[model samples]
Target: MNARIPTDLSSSLKAEEDSNHSDNPSFDTVLAARLSRRGLLRGGAGTVGTVVLGGMGLTACGGGDDPAPTTPPAPGTPTETLLGFGAVAKSLADMVVVPAGYTASVLYALGDPLNAGTAAYKNDGTDTGFENRAGDHHDGMEWFGLDAAGKASATATARGLLAMNHEATTDELRSSFFLHANGGTTTLPRPAAEVDKETAIHGVSIVEVQQAAGKWTTVQNSAFNHRLTCLSDNIQLNGPARGNALMVTKYSTTGVQTRGTLNNCGTGKTPWGSFVTGEENWAGYFTRASTDDTARGGATAKSVVSLKRYGRNAGSRSRHGWETGGADDKYARWNVGQSGASLDGSDDYRNELNTFGYIVEMDAYDKTQMPRKRTALGRFAHESAAFGKPVVGQPLAVYMGDDSRGEYIYKFVSTKTWVAADANPANRITTGDSYLDAGKLYVAKFASDGSGSWVELAMSNPLISGYATYAFADQADVLVNARLAADAVGATKMDRPEWCSTNVNNGEIYFTLTNNSNRAIDSASMPPDSANPRVYEDTKGASTSKGNVNGHILRVKEGAAGNAALVFTWDVYVFGAESGAAAGSVNLSSLTSDQDFSSPDGLAFSPSTGILWIQTDDGAYTDVTNCMMLAALPGTVGDGAKKTLSYTKADTTTLSVDTYVGQAPTADKLKRFLVGPKSCEITGMCETPDGKAMFINIQHPGETTAMADIADPTKYASQWPSNAGYGAGKRPRSATIVITKTDGGRIGS
Candidate 1:
C-alpha cells in the first residue's frame, strides 16, 4: 500500500485560492470587502442519539439488563504479559488507571520556563513578560532526530527536533466572557501588545530534545528551537492560490503570502523527516458585515447565496477580533465579506477567507521557505492529513477527514508517483503539488453490508447535476462548499468524525466518532443504522447532559482500490464503555478497567512495530477516570463477523448504528498503557524510528478558570506539574511528556 510521492493526479485538483493581494481590503468599491463570519460550535456530543468512534458495535440499543456489580476479580486474567503493561492503580484522585510496570512523569508543564531568561506563562493571562513561547491546549505532534554529537549548545538535549500543535483554547480568567472585572466584555479591540501575544500563542513550536537511558529530555535554547506563530512578521504564500487576485490586499501587492496560520491540528511526518500540519476551521476568523450573500451582479456585497455556503451570511460575530482596534488595513484585513471599495482587492476580504484550511508543509530542520497551503485538499475543518507508506516511483496518497458534524472524509492521490529525491526542498511543495494540489477528492458512503464507496466529489458527476438540493457552480465551488456537495451526493453522514489513524501493518483507516447529541429521531437528518449505533440516554454522571457520550472507533481496509478508489470494506473495532455497564452483547467485547474509556480521539499505528495505539479525550465520563492511552493488536477488514445494529431512538422510533458489527477483543486484548495529568489531554503519539522513546502532548492540564477566581489558586481546576496553585510562581501551560523504559528496553516491554 505504499504510494510513490511523485505520482501525478492532476485531473482531480480542487482549488479555493486566495482572491486578494494586500493587507487592506477597504478601497475597491466595486469589490467592497466585508468579513463574513458566524459559528456556534457545539463542543459536546454528536447530533445523533450517539456517535461511535472508529468502532461502535451495536446498530441500535436493544432492551438489556445492566450487569450487577459482583465481588472484585483477580488482578490478572488471560492477558498477554508481553502486551499488557499489567494493571496498576494510581495514587491521586478517586481512580485513574494505568498498565503495570509503566510510570508517568511530567517532562514539562505550563508556565515552566524552557529557557533561562523568559518568564513563565501566568494562567491569569497577564504574563506580559513574553517573547515567543508555548501556548495552551497542546494537541497533535511529531518528532525529528539528529546524531548523538549534534548538539548546537552545551545545554542542548542530545539531538532531535520536537514539533507540537496547540489546537484551541477555553481560556476563562483571561477573557471577560467567563467572568468579569474587565467589564464583562473585551473593552476594546486587541492592542498591538495583546495582539502580539495572541499571535505568538497560535503557531507551532520546534524544539530540540535528546535521549538518555531511553528517556528523552529537552535542549533549552538550542539554535534548532523556533516558534512559528500567527503574528509571524510575514510569510510568503505559494501555489495556484498564491499570487491570484483573490489573495491580494493592501498589505502585499503580489498576493502570494500571509502572516499566520490557525486551528493547527492532527499531524503527518514524512519519510524525509518533514512535518505537515493542517489548518482547520479557518473560515471563522473573518468578520463579514453585509447581510446579503448574493454572488450575482458579480456584486461585491455579501448575498444570501454566498453567506450560507461559507457559514457567514450576516449578523454573526467574528472570533477573537483583534483587528477591531485600528482602521489600519493591517488590523482591518481580518474581516472577509464586502463593505468598502478599495481597488486591487485592498478593501475586499471576502476572497481572502478562502486562503486558509490548507495542508501546510514545513521542513522541521529549516523554516526558510514560506509554507504552502495545499488547496487541493478541499477547504474544510481538516482533521489530519496522513500519507500511506511512501515508496519510490509509486503513487502518493493521503487520507484526511473534515472534523465537523455531517461532513465528508477525503483522500488525495497523486498523478505522478513518488520519487526518493523528491524529498528535498527543490521538490518540497512543487513535488507535493504534483501529488497534493491535484488529486481526486472522495466522500465515503457506508453501506448496509459493511461495504463502502468513495463517491467522487466531481462537478460533472450526475450526483452534482441531478441534485435537487443545491447547484454546483464549478469545481472550485464544489470543493469550497464540499459539505452541501457531499450531502447532495448522498454521502453517509457520520457522528462528528474527528481524528483518523492508519494501521501500518494493514493500511486500515481507524477514526473516532466522538459522541453526538443533536440527532433528532426520525428528523430530516440521516437516521442511525447498524454502522452508527445507540439512540438512548446515558446516565453516567450528571443527567442535565443528554445524548450518547461513550463513543466507538471505525476501521476500514483499503482493499487495493488505492486511496482514490471507489470501493472499500469496513466494520466497528472497539466501543468505549464503563466497566460494569450493560449487556455483554451491548458492551461488545465486555471491556475491563484496562480498556474502559469514553470518547476515543487520537490514534496511531507504529511503523516499526505495527502496534495500534489509542488515546481518549472525554468530557462525558471523566468523573470516573482521567484521560488514558491503550494498546491493541488489530486485524484488517473482512476479518470480523457481520451483524446489523438495531435500537430505540429518543423519540420512540427504532434505529441501527451501522451496516456490519465487529468482533470483540478478548478480555486480554486491549489494555491501558498510561494516564495523563489533571485537566489535560494526552495526544500526539510518536516513537523513535527504533521504537524506543515515546512522546505525547499534555494540553491545558488546568484549563478551567473564572473571572472572579482568576487570582485564587484553589479555584483552579488543576495545578499540574507546578502544583503551586493557579499560575503561582509559574504559569499553568501545556507541555510535552516523554516516556521510555529505564532499563533501555522497548516501551511496554
Candidate 2:
C-alpha cells in the first residue's frame, strides 16, 4: 500500500515478500472438482464459460447476455438507477479527472499546516513540524459530520472532520528523500532529524473541514484537528492479547501501552461512532538481527516462529533503516532483536512488533481520547475492518482481510450483543471495548459448491489445540499467530484480500482481492484455483506481468441474513481487465471500456444511497491508464450462476476450473467515475450524508520518479496538485480531493 519506490525494491517484489506459502487446498481445485462432479466441465475448450449448476442460469464472460432477477429494493429505499453520470474517459494527464458537470478541488495535501502556529509548506523538501502538518500518502478515510452547533451530527452536510491514514512516505536509499533537503542521507547511521520527521508522518490525522460560499477548506486551527504519529504517547492496548507475555516490550513492561501506529492502511467507521484503522505492512518497519533466533532459543522457539509467521525473519532490513539512527529509545524501538537479559522480552524491544498489526480505535471527535488497539480481531497484514450491519440484540460482527498473497479472510463476532442506545454512547472508546475486546475470531474456508464456512480460531477448536506445526499456548497466542491457526484449520487462501465493504441495502459484504504475482497455471506451490482462476500474461509496453494480472471483486452473503452466521454463499462479483482482453477467461466480467479497472483496493458503500464506490492501487495496468475509481450497483450473492474456465498450459494441455460468477454489470450499473494523476494510486473514499459531496485521496503521485532526480522537477512522473495550481512548488504531493456536481445536485446523479 505505500506504493513508494526504492532503488533496490519494486512494489511488486515488496508484495511478494509477504506471500503465504502454506499447503492449504486452493479454491481453484475445489471449484474444479465441484463442477466436474456436477457434470458442468466441457470436454474440449479454449475457454468455456457456461455451466449451469442446479437451477441458476449460466453465461460466458459477457455482460448483458443473461440478466438475472435482482432483489427488489427494501421498503422506502431509493429506487434510482445506480450510476447516473456519464463515464469519465481514461487519462494519462498530470491532474485528476472526473466526469463532465463535476468539479474536483484539492482539500488537503501533504505538509499543509494543521495548526496556525505551523509555518506554511514551501514544498521544497525542507518542511518540518510534521506533527502539526498533513502527513504523506493520505489513505483510507472516513467522514465524521458536525452540526451547526459544532456537535456530532450524522446527517450534517456542510461541515465535518476527515480522519485518514497517512500510510507511509516516499523512501529510497535509506531515506524518505522527498521530505528532506537535497534528498537527505542515503547511507547507514541515518540522521536523527531525518528519522524523526519520517516517524512523525506515518500514522493517522483527524482534521476538521467546512464548506463556505461553495468552497471547502480545512479548519487549520479547529479544535477537532489532531495528528497521531509514531512518536505520540498514550496509545493503549485492549482485548485478549493485551498484557500477554509475548507483548511485553521495554517501552511497555505491562504490555498494555505502546507508541504510535504505523502503516495505517485501510480504515473503518465503527458502529459506535469511532475511527478504526488497520496497521498494514508494519513488520517491515522493524529490523531483526540474524542472531535473534539464537538469542531467543533457536529456530523452533515460539518467538521465532511467531516472528517468521508474521513475515519478520532474522536479518530482515528495516524499510527506511530508522533503527540505525542512534541509541535513543525513539530509534532503538525499531530494532526487535533480542538484546536485553530478560527472557520474557520486557527489557528490550524484542516484542515491539507485537504491539502493532491491530485494528486501532479512536474517537475522532475527542482528541483527548487515546487510541486503543483491538487485539481480539487477530493480527496479520490487516487491510480493513468492515463491521456488519448492526441488529439490536445480536452479536456484532466485523470482517477483515490479511492483505498478502495466499492469506485468509477473518471475521470476529463479539460475545456481547449490540444495543441501539450504544450508538451514541457517552464514551466511544468504552463502547468499542464492549464489542471489540471479547470475540470469537473465525477464518473462512470456501468449499467447491459456492458455499463457505467460518472456522473458529480459538483454542477450543481441535485443529488449533492439536496443531503440530506451531503449538498454541493460549488464546493470546492464537490471536497473535492467527495466520498459523488459520493454516492449521485448513482455511482457503485468497489472492491478496485488501478491503471489505458492507452493502447498506442488503448487508452483503464485498472484498477486493488485489492481484497476486504468486498465482500460476503450472506452479506446484501456488497454482490457480477456482476462486482465483486467472493465469495469463499482460504486456504494458516491454514490461510483462503475469498471474491474475488484473484482480477481481468477491462478495459473500451470510446465511440466515445474520452477520454471525457461520455459513455463507459467495461469487466473483467482477473480474478486473482491459476492455480489449480476451473474453470468457481474462475478461470474465465482460467489462467495457467504461467499466474496466485493475487492483480494486479501497471500497466503501455510501450509507446515503447504497452505491458501492471502488478505488484502485494498480501496477499491472498503469501503462494503459493511471489507477482509477469506479461506481457500481451490485446484486446479492446467488443472483448469478456458475461458469467453467480453461487455461492452456505450456504442454498444450488445459486445466479447467468451475467458478461461481456474479451477474455481469451493464454500463448503467457499473462505470468509471474518476482517474488519478500519473504514477499515483486512487484510494480512500468517503461521502457526505446527502451524497452531494464526495472525497477521495490521490496517493504518491509522481512516485515513479527516480530518487536521484528529486531536485529536478522536469524528471518527475507528475507535478500534480502543483500543476493543478494547488501548492507552492513543482513537487507532487498526495492530497485529498473533494468532488461535487456543478449543477448543485447529488454526485453521480
How far does residue 312 in candidate 2 sit from its true spot (Å)? 1.3
| Cα error of candidate 1 at position 470, Å | 5.6
Cα error, candidate 2, residue 349 (Å): 0.8
lDDT of 1 by residue, 524-564 (tens): 45345445654334554334333344667887776565654
Task: Identify the runs in model 2 with alpha carbons over 4 angstroms from their true place.
Answer: 2-7, 10-19, 29-81, 648-654
Best candidate, lDDT: 2
Global lDDT of each candidate: 0.56, 0.83
Scanning candidate 2 in windows of ten residues, the lowest lDDT window is 53-62
Steric clash count of candidate 1:
110
Please give the lDDT score at residue 174 for candidate 1.
Answer: 26
lDDT string, candidate 2, 75-131, tens digits:
767554447666765656666767655778888999999999999999998889999
